[model samples]
Target: MLDAVLLILREVLEAALILSLLLALSQKLHLQFRWSLIAVTIGTIGSWLLAHYAYEIADAMDGTGQELLNAALYSVVILSVIALGLFICPLAFKSHLENNLTQKKIFASPSGKKLIYRLCIVIVSFSLAREASEIWIYLSAFTHDTEMLSSALIGSAIGAGIGMSLGASTYYAFTFMQKSYFIPVFLAIITLLAGGLSMQIAKQLMQIGWLDSATPLWDSTFLVDEHSWVGELLYALIGYDSRPAPIQGIFYLLTITPVVSACAWHAWQLRVKTHE
Candidate 1:
């Protein structure tokens, strides 16, 4: 239940952040409100469709095929999280490119009437791919459990609602009170989540034997059951495993520490640039 909630929350939060950035950019650029709304609507629909399809595909697989599918899905999730850590985390601190692109599309359109449609499709496709990919991974993780599936979906809806509300509030606060003040904090949180997700993916993949070199660096199985509250909380937030294999531990540290350090450096650079 907790894992389901965390997965949904993280994915929904990321989507909300992306959409909010796009919407805020549109307002900043003085773009048409209708066009922005259309874009967001299309993006949301596309993401939903893609997520449905991914769930269907997972549902169809069984036996060894299901295991293989799960393994592949997790591997993709890990890589995607790593990519976000390396690229998107830094980009979030910078100006909004989606808004810039929308502005360009609007200006370049021969007929202003068609600009909204074109912009909507483009933005929808872009955001949908990222959002759906994350959703697919989360769904794949719990494909075998009907109760967990329902719980995750409910959690995702709730998380999305919370995220949308927060996003709206953030936009208002930034626009009215302190311009760009929240970007650093937002970037930091995203970086940490991405790092943690990547670590979790690595650990999961190692468990499935998709990766080589397995030996526990330290076994804390005696300390706590993984399903216990303390264990589960650490697992959800920090990707902590009490009995992690040596290679898993190494991969976790290797993937998380550098990404975090890099994000910190990026945040510092953004701060300096803002001041200058």
Candidate 2:
């Protein structure tokens, strides 16, 4: 039960943290939660359906189907975060959509609203599906074992309760900070999270022989092993891999470089507008 609770808590908090950040964003954008609600519903159904076909999924892609699917989900999350962060940044706005190519053209135009709405849907649904599927897979594994049926059910319930409680606490904490006017800081954290998730995708790709990674650059396991509880929490939250492969580092930098450049470009455009 303890193991179950910890496992569920870790995964739930990961997905919940993303949701909390998005919820804070809805307030900033004056958007309704209707789409988010829909996302959750769809995500719940989708995860259950996927869980139903767990065997095929696990065996697909040369036994790396799950990794591939997770990579795709993480990609969606990373892209959505980047899109959402553009809106979160106060200076991101379009100026006639003709003045400059480097200007913030995403959330500042007519189609921007629709884009944001689509992004919100993906953000919520994909996040929920990614985390929920893992829990379902774990819990489902024991269903066929008659002796472990009772234990599995009880553990799942207890785990879910603890996970939800912790998730709620995390949401409230982020909300408090957002209300206190720390939105930029929050966006920065999200940028890192997105980059980290992208790195995880790179790792998954390598796992399936799609990406070639040379070797480990260095090992920090002695300092912070990735198997430890704190390591797992950090992994879920920020993609903190202690013994990161060289490709992971390269990919993480590659992902963040453009995002940072875009932020800089937007800042420059904002300055140019102010001067004019």
Candidate 3:
């Protein structure tokens, strides 16, 4: 039962937080979130497909197929996130880009709006598919154990409720924040999430011996027990790990550096223009 609760909570919170952020972003932009329905439907189907083929996939590519596929999928997500970040960066720091009419038109144009919506849909669908398939696979294992299955179902429900509540609270908090802080805060959250995901990709590659493993830089379990509720929340929110390898940090930095560099460059450009 405890296992069920933790697993469900982790997956639910991860997806819920991401979806909530996307919805909040849409609302902030004065755009409709109707596309979420389509994303959910597609994601549901994807979850079933991925779960159904789990064994076959694991058996392929010299038993490294699962790792390879996960790495590929994660790469897609990270790239999509970077693209989204680039798109939003100008708007977030518009005080600097205000004189650049092209940047302004990018937000106002219908094509730009479509691109944003499409990116959000892609992120949500992939995230949901990846997360929900794990739950499906786990729950499917207890089909023969009626008693255990019942307990698991109850635990899952409780976990889901808690996760949804937390996610909603996060969304409301974003909504309540002053407009000046919203975009920057959103960017920071996404950056942390993306970096954490890149760390996961590093782990996945290392599992297949594609990426060399390194000793953990430090143990943080004393500060935040990875198995505890707070740990779980942080894991879902920022991909927190109690013992993180140096290689993982490298992967994280590599993934986030582009976005950070671009933002810095934009800020410098803005400073120069201001001085002019």
Candidate 4:
């Protein structure tokens, strides 16, 4: 139950942060508020539909078929996490689209409204795609048990609601707080979370034989089993695994360290540029 709650919190927070950033960008650009809200609504609905389909597919498999399905789901989770970590990090730091949108004065025209609506639709589709991909991966992990499924679904819904509210509040707070200071801090938190998730994905892939080399770099399984509260907390926050394979360890270091360093450097450059 605690694990389920933690999962929901992390995933929901990630989605909320992404949506909030996009919404904030829209506001900065002086985009039509109604159209933006409509886009978000469409995106949320589309994500829920995709998650439902994933759950249905998982429910229909059994025995060896179930094993195969789980493997596939794990693969999807790893791939999606990698893709999102790569794509979102750069965008968070160096999004020029928002700046371009802000510069446009034609939004006051009738054709501009039409263009904005079309743009909003595209944004909605893209956002939904990202969210759906993540949600599907998450659902795939625990779709086997009836009780777990129920808990995950209910917890995810509640978490998403709370996260969205928190995100909105944070955005409003930052409006008065100085975006120059807030942006890096926000990006740092996200980078850490993504880095941790990436490590977990690498570990999962190695465990399921989807990846090569299954030797543990250091067997810490003796210290607080992952089911324990301390272990679970570490796992949720920092991707802590007691018995991680060598390849998993290598992948974690290779993938997360470089990406996080690059992100930090990029954010620094952006800050310098903003000041200049």
Q: How accurate is candidate 3 locally (lDDT)?
A: 0.86
Q: Give the winner by TM-score.
A: 3
**What's the distance in Å from true for residue 206, model 2?**
1.7
- Model 2 regions lying over 4 Å from their true place: 90-111, 178-180, 269-276
Q: Better model by TM-score, 1 or 3?
A: 3
> Candidate 3 lDDT, tens digit per residue, 111-147?
9989988988888888888889899999999999999
Worst 10 residues of 1 by lDDT: 61-70
Runs with alpha carbons beyond 4 Å of true place in candidate 4: 1-7, 21-46, 55-161, 213-245, 253-276
Q: Per-residue lDDT of 116-219 in model 2, one digit per residue for the tens?
A: 67888898788888778878888877778866766766766776676667667766776666332545566677888887898899899988888987778888
Higher-ranked by TM-score: 1 or 2: 2
Report how far off residue 223 is in candidate 1 (Å). 12
lDDT of 4 by residue, 1-276 (tens): 545555555555555554555455446445556766676676667666656665564456432333344344334433443343443344457555653343353454667546545544544444444445566678677778888888888877776666667678866765554444554554454445445555665654554456775567787778767666567555644557787767666656654565577677777988998899
Against the correct fold, how does model 4 do in TM-score? 0.49
- Identify the superior model by TM-score, candidate 3 or candidate 4: 3
Cα RMSD (Å) per model? 8.5, 4.4, 1.9, 7.7
Task: Report lDDT (CA) for all predictions.
Answer: 0.55, 0.74, 0.86, 0.56
Please give each candidate's TM-score.
0.44, 0.83, 0.94, 0.49
